[model samples]
Target: MAARITARRPSPERRRTARMTSSDWANPYGVRKPYGSNGANHGDGGEKGATLSADHPLVPWKQPDHVHQWVDVDHSREELDRFVRNWPDLGELLDANVGHGRVVIVSGPPGMGKTTLIHRCLYEVQQRVAATGPSAGDPLAVFVPTAGLENDGRRISVDPDGSFAPTRLINARIRSEITKKLLLHEFSESRVRAITAEEDPYQAYGEMSDLLVQRNALLFAVIPHIRWNDAHLRAAFLRTCLSHAHTRIVLFVEVSHGAAETAREVAAALSGSAAVTHLALRELNSEDIWRFSRSARAANGAPNGLVEPDRSSLMAAHDEWKPSDVRELRKVFHSAADALRRAPHPWPIDADALRPHWERRRAGRDALLRHPILPRSGG
Candidate 1:
């Protein structure tokens, strides 16, 4: 009989110091909180986030459990087509923001890596801040996801015990950003609400800006949700930020719906303003068939992802796959891989070996995609 595992309760002493303390070497922040304890973890590289040279905890949902080490820069470039377009390079975005303080709106379809690209860019920019102070050499930059903020501009939260509790994640992020002197906010449209009398994006933007000004920090906000609502002039918010800051402002608006309308709004909003640059992302033009579609018999002879000689057929294929759909495509690929994990050391993941399973997945993948995306205009 197999032994049953049970949840062990922590003793009083253990519970008292349940939290992990951060070393001065690990992170500048004193106490590091793990994921799901109170809120999400901010950019602390765990075993998962360690895959990349820089730590990005905000978008952990997008991380792959096992990316084959064999995939080189060329392979990743070929595989990740979404990041290649609007962002030809993350350095460009960083340079524009750091050098000019420009607001860059990255518009694209859902799952096309808008969030992934933004996070990656911010991570690289932040490394400069981590190494030297924003005042030391380079301007400091910090990445913040605004899903947790309230529109009233309130930064503190009250617990049931009537004690004032601030979001550790936001507090940690703010501490890092203010200390560094750059604030890169990842503001989401869905989660934000109007706490103050002003509407969302405006009210929220005002509050955040006031906080940054109070702290005397430079702002570099990246908002994934820039909805197109022509009914009200949304340009006011962008214009407001631009007017206040002597520096250029960036708005990385990843629009899932109304890309055309959103772009038009941006252009109209910044008609006189030359600082705001809007970049649009489209699908990749490449061969649908992958050379590595030999996952079935190919898995048998390979030593941990290294395929053997000649008996090669990789897993994962798509007839009508789009570049932006890579995230969804990986979900299907991993699901198939998980289903086949126990069968053999290397699962036969070729088209023939996995087609039936994929068909079942397609047939049953009936859930409506919640995020609305505009069609890619052109290459």
Candidate 2:
């Protein structure tokens, strides 16, 4: 008989790591089709694997920087046009070698396209910078989502004095977030690992800043929703980022309109001493949504003979859902199109037809938006 061959099962931690490392798990947002593709996809939840039709008014929905497309900025769309026109000052700030620290607070209601706008602006700046020439000192914008920075769902080491406990924990989380971004930027993996391993997170962060400075690169970190309680931790991180004194770094803090206190705290941390820029995004009304939809339809151009939504049907769905923000509007239209596609005939589909489907998806979608990414602890 052959010697007994036993395959030791992977440790729980290893198994968890394997699961988290999967493409779908890493990017909760599923693989996006090439830009200008008729349909888009959200990750596996709510409307699991639901693909919008090419001719759907909201086919190419708003997305993060990784999947952003220049074509999404339709000049005919009032909101998109105004957002781009009013956004130049900050864009200039990011591209300029100002050699100082600054903070830009972009406040808006939930689902108002704050992240999408910021990503688009940064994407434009990147394009312009490339046209000028490639240099180490070029400004590099890094997006850092802060939802997971809070508690991180990991048991923390108790500290009686409470002096460094929160700082240590939050710093580690922040360091991890930045490390992932740097790796994506093609920074050395071994070097990144070594830097993250530094005992002091602030020191490690400073090393990150120095690395950018050495290459004459500026780091524009876009962190959304800095909780009121975590304001100080963010402030501390900002201080570390500005350590270079000569290396210009920008911190773009995004908060919902309801989080006034959080925004004030983060701004106060700057003490009115550092350069600060503020912009507010208002929720869209039905008219604005209608205008955006019409403009998008024209700009995106549907396939010939493809049943397109008329304003009446689109308005009917809008009235049914009564969407409160850009995000909700996108979902409403996308779901309406999905319903139309599933119909036995190409007859017009309205909100009533999508109501049951939308209702069933509401709870799951709300939960997902609340915690888009709950990063598991550990490497």
Judged by TM-score, which candidate is best? 2
Evaluate model 2: give its TM-score: 0.57
Measured on C-alpha atoms, candidate 2 has an lDDT of: 0.46
The collision pairs in model 2 are 136-215, 137-216
Say what the RMSD of model 2 is: 15.7
Model 1 error, position 238 (Å): 6.1
- Could you tell me how far off, in angstroms, the CA of residue 200 lies in candidate 1 after the best superposition? 12
lDDT at 368, model 1: 16
Q: Provide TM-scores for the models.
A: 0.48, 0.57
Candidate 1 wrong stretches, greater than 4 Å: 1-101, 129-140, 148-216, 226-250, 258-274, 284-316, 320-324, 364-368, 371-379
Cα displacement (Å) at residue 270, model 2: 4.6
lDDT of 1 by residue, 316-373 (tens): 2333332234334444444454454343333334444345455555554534133322
Q: Ten residues in a row with the worst lDDT in model 1?
A: 23-32
